[model samples]
Target: MEGRLENGQYWQGWTVEAPVGVVVFVHGVHEHGGRYAPVAARLGEAGYACYAVDHPGHGRSPGNRGNIDGMDTTVAGVAALVTMAADRHPDVPVFVYGHSLGGLVALTYLTGERHPRVVGAVISAPALDTSASNAVQRAFAPVLSRFLPDLGVLALDIEAVSRDPEVVAAYRADPLNHTGKIVARTGAEILTAATAMPARLRGLTLPLLLVHGGADRLMPVSATEVVRAHAASPDLTVRVFDGLYHEPHNEPEKAEVLTEIVAWLDAHLPPAPA
Candidate 1:
C-alpha cells in the first residue's frame, strides 16, 4: 500500500499478514524496503505480520536518489509506517527490525517517540559508527551539506556489503537500490546521528536485541558497544557473528542469524490473549 506524509513525501509499504505479532523492517541506506521482502516473508512464516516501507529518496518513494533532507525525515517516515501498522492491527504487539542505517532510525524512534504498542526492537548491524569515511570526509561533510546538499560525497562499496558473492552481485544489480555516492546532507546527517545516538539511547527503556557481524567493515562492530554502554534497556541482548560482513541477515550464516532473531522475538512477545 501507499501513504503520503504531511511533509508531502510519499512512501510505499509492503506487508505479510499474520496474527501473532508485527515486525516492521527498517532497511539500510541506499536500499529500499522491497529488498527486505524475503526477510519479512521469513518472519511471516514465523507468525508475524511483517511491514516495511521505502523511505523518501531511497526507493519507489519520490525524491533525489541517495539523499534525504535530514535524519528526522527518515525517522518520521518509519514512525508513520509503524503507526499505520498499529492502527490496522490494534492490540497486536509491534517489534522493530532494523539493519544498518535502519538500525539508527529504529533506535531514534524507540527512544524519542511514545508508542505503547511497540513491545521491543531488534537491530542488526546498526550504523551507529561508520568506518567508510575518512577524517577529511567527516570534517567536510557538514560544510558541504549546507553549501551543496545534493553533491555526492561518499560511495558505498558493494564488495564490503556481504561475504557471499551472489548477495553482492544481486545488490549491485538491483535498480531500486541507490548505487551512487551518498549526497552531502545525507552523509552529514548520518555522521551527526552516529555521534548523537548514544546519548539519546540512554532514554531507551524497552526490551532490545542488538546483533552485528564481527567483521563488518562499513559500520564497525565497536559501534554496538556504544549502545551497550548508554542504552538503559534492562532487557538488552547483544550478539556478534564472527567473520561476517555488513549485512548479517544476507550473509552466509543467515539462517542462524535469523533463527536467533526469531527466538528473541518469541521470547519477548506479549502473552497471547486468554
Candidate 2:
C-alpha cells in the first residue's frame, strides 16, 4: 500500500496475512523505499509486514533532491512511520531496519523519547563517520551549510556499494537512486548527528543488532564497532561479513545476511499472548 505522512510525504508498505510483527525500513540519503521491495517481500513471506518512506527530497517525495533541512527532520520522518506501523498492527511487535544514512536516523530515533515503542532494530552499514570526506570538505561543510546548504560537496564511490558487478550496474541504472554529490547541509547534519551518538548510544537498552561488511569502504566496519562498543543494549549482536561491500544484503551471499536477520527477528519477538 502507498500513502502519505501527516506532512504529505509519500511512503509504501508490504503486508502479509496475520503478520507476526512489522518491520519499517529507513533508506539512505539518495535512495527511496521502493528499492527495498524485494527485501520487504522476503520479510513479508516470513510473516512480517514491512514499510518504507521516501525521505523528504528523495525519490517521489517532494523537496529539493539531495538535500535535507536537518537530522531532526529526518528523525521525525522515521518517527511518523514507526507510529503508522504500530497503529496499523496493534498487539504486534515493531522493528526498524535502517541502512547507511537511515541507520543514523534510526539510531537517533532509538535514542529518542519514542524508542520504547520499538522492540528492536537492525542497523546496517550506519554512516556514523565520514572517512570519505576530505579534510577540506569536512572543514568547509559546516560553514558552507550555513551559507550554501545546497552546495554539493562529495559523491559516493558507487563501486564501494557492492562487490557484485550486477548490483553496481543496477544501482547505477536506478533512476530513483540519486547519483549525485552529497549536499553541504545534509553532510553537516549527518556529521553532527553521528558525532553525538556515542554518548546517546550509552542510554540504549532495547534489543539491537548491528551488521556491516568488513570490506565496506563507504561506512567502515570500525564505525559499527564503535556502536557495538558504546550501545548499552544488553541484547545487542554484531555481525561483520568479511570481504563484503557496503550492501551486504545485496551482495552475492545475501542469503547469509537475510537468514541471520530473520533468525534474530524470531528471537526478539515479543512474548506470545497469554
Candidate 3:
C-alpha cells in the first residue's frame, strides 16, 4: 500500500497473487503515482503487478513541490523501485512504464549506466522537448536556475491534460495534483536531459514501446519520432493516437491504448513454467 524509501521518498504500489509479470510505473510531474490506480487494476487483472513511486517533490514524497536538484535524483528513485520489485518477484519479468515527465525518467533509467535490467519499457508522451510556447522560459532557465532555482516558472494548463471534462475536473480537484509553478532548476534539468536524449537513446538496446498522442499539445508527436529514430532497440514500436490529447490512458480511447500495451507486454512475456 504505502511505504517510505531509505532515501525518504514515499512510494505506493499494488500487486496480485502469482503475478505473471511486474511493471514499475513512474508518474508525471505535478501528479502523484496514485492516479494510476485504474490502470494498475487493469494490468493486475491481466496478471501483472504494478509498483510506482512518487518523485521527491511530488505526490506523497517530501520536497519542495516541482523542484529537484537534477534529473539524476528522479532516475535513481526509479532504479530503487525497480530493485525492490525484483527482490519481491525474482521470477517475474519487470517492465517500466512512465507517462509524460515520468516517461523521460524511465528512458533515462534504461539508458543510464549501472541500472537494473528490465525486460522492456513503455514511454507515453514523454516531455522530450520544451513546448514551443515555453521557448522563452527555456532560454532563461539556466540563468534563473543559478540565482532562483526554487523560483516558480510555469503553471500546467489542466485543460491540456486530457480531452475528457470529467478527467479534467478530477485532476483539478485532486489535492495531490500539484498546481504550482515549475521550479527554475527543475525546468533547466528537464531541458538539458531532453536535449541529450537523442544521443542517449541511440544506446538503448532493450525491448521498448513508445506511445504518444498526435494531438498532444504538451509533448508533440515529433518528439516520439526522434526517440524512435535514434533508439537502437531492435524491437522498438511507436504508436501515435491520432485524435487523443496528452493522456491516452485517461482518454475515451484508453481501453484501446491499454490493449495495445498489454499486447506488447504479453508478446515479450517470459515463457511459462512447464
Candidate 4:
C-alpha cells in the first residue's frame, strides 16, 4: 500500500501477518525502497511483516532526487514509521534496519530520548567515521549549500561501486534512479554523524548488529571498527565481510549475512505473543 507521512513524504510497503511484528527499512542515498524488496520479502517469508520507505526526494517519495537534507529529518521519519507501523501491527515489536546513511540515522534515533519501539536493529555497512567524503565536504560545503541544496552531482555513480551488478543495473535503469541533485546540507548531516560518533558510541543500549564491507570505498571500514571499539552495549556484534563493498547485505555473500541477521533478531526479539 501507498501512504503519505505528515512530513509530506510517501511510502510503499507491505504487511504479511496480522498483528505480527514489523520491520522498517531505510535505504541509503541515491537508491529507493525497491532495492530492499528481496530482503524484505525474505523477512516476510520468515513471518515478520517488512516495510521499506523511500526517503524524501528519493525513490517514489516526493522531493528532489537524492537530496535527503539531513539525518534528523530522516530519523524523525523512521520514528514516525515505527509509530505508524506499530499502529497497524499493535501487539508486536517493530525493528528498524538501515544501510549506509540510513544506519547512522537509525543510530541517532535509537540513542535519543524519543526512541522507536524496536527490540533490535540491523545496520549494514554503516557510515560511522570519516573518509574522503568528509574532507571534501567540510572544506567546500558551506559555499555549495548556500547556493545548491540540489545540484545533481555524481558521488561515484551507482554503478561503479556496487558488488551486485544486477542491482546496480536496475538502479541505473529505474525511471526514478537519480544521479543528480544531492543536497549539500544532506552531506553535512552525514559528516556531523561521522564527527560525533566517538562521544556517542558508548551510550547505545538497544541490541544492534553492525555489518561492514572491508573494501567499501564510500564509507571507510574503520567506521565499524570505531563503533565496536567504544560500544557500551554488550549485546552489540560486528561482522566484517571480506572482499565485500559498500552494501554488504546485497553482496554475493548476502545469504550468510541474512542468516546471521535472522538469528540475531530471533534471539533479541521474542516470538510473537501467543
Candidate 5:
C-alpha cells in the first residue's frame, strides 16, 4: 500500500488483481493523493484499479511544505507512478487523471519527452494559465523566488474549492489539507508552467477529456478552452459544468462528473484480452 520512489519520495497507492483498467491519479496542490480514496473506490467498484502518490512537500511525502524545486521533478515523479501502474497491469490500459495543480503535472507528463505510455488522460480544473496569487504578488514573483524561495505568498481560499458546503467544511477540518501559504518558488513555477502550457498542448496527441467548472474562480473555464483549441488530439473532449466551482468532483453534482469520467474511460479503453 505504501512505498518509496527511486528518488526517495514516499508514496501510497492501491491496485486490484484483475481490473478492466487502471487510473493513475495526480492530486491538486496543497493536498495529498489520499484525498481521492472515494474517487478511487468508485472507480474500483467499476472494475478499475487506482493509484496515486503524494507530491513532494505535500501529504505524507517528505519535502519543504508548499515548495517544489522545479516542474520537471514533479513530472518525473508522476511518470514514475505511471510506469509502476503499467508494469503491474501490463494487460490493462492505464489512464491518467489529474486535478488542479496535478492537472498541470499530468499535462506536462503526457506532452513531455520522457513519459510512460497511457491510453488517455482526464484533467479536471487544470492550472494551465492561472496562479493563486494576486497581481502584485505575480509581478514580484521572480524576484521573490530568487531572494526568498521559501517566502509564503498566497493563502488558499477554501471557499473557492467546491459548491458543497460539507466538502468545504471537510477540507477545513482535514489535517492533511494544507492551508498554508504558497512558497515564492512554487508560485513562480506554477506561473511559468501555466504560461508555457498552451504551446505544449499543440504536441499532445493523446486522447484527452478536459473538464472544468464554468464558475471555477481558481482556474477559469477559459483556460480549458485554450487547451482544447491547441491540443493536437483529434479525440479531445471538453465539458464545462455551468455552476460548478474548482472541484466539480466534490460538488453537489459530483455524480455527474464521476459518471462522465467513468463513461469516457469505458469508451476509450477496451477490456483486456483473455
Candidate 6:
C-alpha cells in the first residue's frame, strides 16, 4: 500500500487482483484513492483488475500537505505505477480512470509521452481548465504568495467553501482530503492545462469517456461539453448525470456510476490485439 519509488518519492495506492485487464485509478486533489474502494470492488467482482494510486502529498503518499508543483511529477509518478502494473499483466489493455485533478493528471500523463501505451481513458469532470479563475489568480498570486506563500491562496472558492452544506459535509468527512490550499505555482499549471484543453481535445485520439455531473459547481459541465463538442476522437462519448455533484463516482448513486464506468470500460477495452 505504501512504497518509495526508485526516484525517492513515496507513493500509495490500492491494488485489486483480477485476471482481466488492469484499471489504474487516480484520485483528485485533497482526496485519496481509498474513496474508490466500492468502485474497485464492483469492477473486481466483474472480473477486471484494479489499481488505485494516491497522488504525491495526497492520502498516504509521502509529501507535505499540498506540495506537488506543476502536476508533471505526479503524472510521471502515475506512469511509473502503470509501468509496474504492466510488468505484472503483460500486453493487457491498461485503462486510466481520473477524477477532477486526477483527470488532468491523466491527461498530463498522455500528453507529451508514450510510456505506458494506455488502451483507453475515463475522465470524470476533468478540470481541464479552472473555468474562469485564471485572470485573477495570475494577477494577484504574486502579491499574495509574497506575504502568505503557504496560505493556500489560489483562486476559486471551490464548492466546499460555498453555501452548499452537503458538499462541505462530504469534504470535511474525508480525512484524506485537504482544505482550500493550492500553491501559486500549482494554480499556474492548472491555468496552463485549462488553456490547452482545446488543443488537447483535438489531439486526443484515444478512446475517452468524459463524465460530468449536471449539477457540479466547482467543475462546471461546460468543460466536458466543450471537449465533447470539439474532440476529434472518433470514440469520444460524454455522459451528463442528472443531480450528481462534482464527484459522481462518490455520489449517492455511486453504484449506478460505477456500473456505467464498468460497462463503458468493458465495451471499449477489448482483451488485447491478439
C-alpha lDDT score of every prediction, in listed order: 0.85, 0.89, 0.87, 0.75, 0.85, 0.72
**TM-score per candidate, in order?**
0.93, 0.96, 0.95, 0.90, 0.94, 0.86
Candidate 3 ranges with C-alpha deviation above 4 Å: 114-117, 131-136
All predictions: root-mean-square deviation over Cα?
A: 1.8, 1.2, 1.5, 2.2, 1.8, 3.2
lDDT of 5 at 147: 91
Q: How far is candidate 6 from the true structure (C-alpha RMSD, Å)?
A: 3.2
Error of 4 at 51 (Å): 1.4
lDDT of 3 by residue, 75-100 (tens): 88888889998888888888999998
Clashes of each: 0, 0, 0, 1, 0, 2
TM-score of 6: 0.86
lDDT of 1 by residue, 67-139 (tens): 8778888888889878888888886899998898899888888888747899999988888876678999889
Candidate 2 residue pairs in backbone clash: none
Give residue 234's error in model 1 in angstroms: 0.8
Stretches of model 5 off by over 4 angstroms after superposition? 114-116, 131-136, 271-274
- Backbone clash pairs for candidate 1 read none
Residue 108, candidate 2: alpha-carbon lDDT: 93
Name the candidate, 2 or 5, with the larger TM-score value. 2
* Rank by lDDT (best first): 2, 3, 5, 1, 4, 6
Q: Is candidate 3 or candidate 5 better by lDDT?
A: 3
Models ranked on TM-score: 2, 3, 5, 1, 4, 6
Better of 2 and 5 by lDDT: 2
Cα miss at 65, model 4 (Å)? 1.7
Q: Deviation in angstroms for 180 in model 5?
A: 1.5
